[model samples]
Target: MKKIAVIYWTGTGNTEAMAHSVADGARTAGAEVAIQCVGDIAADTAAGFDALALGCPAMGAEVLEETEFEPFFAELEPQLGGKTVGLFGSYGWGDGQWMRDWKERTIAAGANLCGEPVMANEAPGVTELDECRALGEALTK
Candidate 1:
């Protein structure tokens, strides 16, 4: 089975919920899944997985969590070339500029983006959850 990692950072638990939904979809698709917080897994850990799903909520000015997720992601960026990568997150405000920027960055890093980055306004609703699942499923393809 393909080994997939679903890594995320959550402040209000909204992104965490999306992470679980992603893991569920990966599991259902017959992939071995590892779900972890960004702090628990190092940037190099991403190399071990066949595909990766990363999540982090939008922060000030619609940016990634700078103190943690950003630095971690920067470390991982160089490793993304030719890898299957999925990005998702929750936003309290703003027009999802973070996700758009993130998508572009991931592509620039040479990753084959699974799909459009999934974004939720606050806590994800059913639609968002389903989109998260689709993101996970895309990794299986």
Candidate 2:
């Protein structure tokens, strides 16, 4: 089975909900999934997974959560070469600029993106949850 990690950080719990949806989908698709908070994981832990689903809320002027997620991601980025990565998040404002920037960063890090990054305006609903699931299934592909 594919080893997949669903790693994320949440402020208002929207992104945490999204992460669970992603993990559920990956599990359904027959992947071994580890769903974890960003703070609970080490950067090198990413290397053990066949694919990654990363999540964080868009914070402060359309950027990633500065304190925890950003620094964790920065450490993980350099190790992403040839890795399969999927991204999802929630945003309160802006035109999904954070996701755009994140996608660019992932590409620059040499990750093989699994699918389009998934984003929801606030709390994700049924549609957004389904999309997150699809993104997870893509990681197994």
Candidate 3:
């Protein structure tokens, strides 16, 4: 089975909720999955996973949360060569630049995005959550 890792950091539970849905979809497609918060993640854990799902909310000026998620992901960037990755997040405002910039950063860091970034304006409703799951399945396949 394909093993996937979902790493996220949520301040208001929106991204965390999305992470669960992503894991659900990955499992539905027969992939083994581990969902973890950024602080809980151990370096090199992605070594065993076939795909990666990364989640974080867009911070001020459409930047990544620097305290935890950014640093963790920055550390992860080095090890992501040849890895399949999916990006997801919730944004309160702006033009979704965070996702776009994040996509660019991930690509530059050597991780191939499985598909377009999944994002919601605030908390995800059913439709957005469904899309997140679909993204997970697609990433594994």
- Among the numbered candidates, top lDDT falls to 2
Query: What shift in Å separates residue 21 of candidate 3 from its native position after superposition?
Result: 0.8
- lDDT assessment of candidate 3: 0.90
TM-scores of the models, in the order given = 0.98, 0.98, 0.96
The list of candidate 3 runs beyond 4 A from truth reads none
Q: What would the TM-score be for candidate 2 when compared with the true structure?
A: 0.98
Q: Candidate 1: give the clashing pairs.
A: none
Residue-by-residue lDDT tens digits, candidate 2, 1-141: 899999999988999999999999899999999999999999898767999999998998889999999999999999999999999999986899999999999999999999999999899999999999999899988
The better-scoring model by TM-score among 2 and 3 is 2
lDDT at position 125, candidate 1: 100
Q: Give per-model CA RMSD.
A: 0.7, 0.7, 1.0
Question: Which lDDT tens digits does candidate 1 get at residues 1-141?
Answer: 999999999999999999999999988898999999999999997777999999999997888999889999999999999999999999986998999999999999999998988999999999999999999998888
lDDT of 3 by residue, 58-115 (tens): 9978999989988888888888888999999999968899989999999998888888
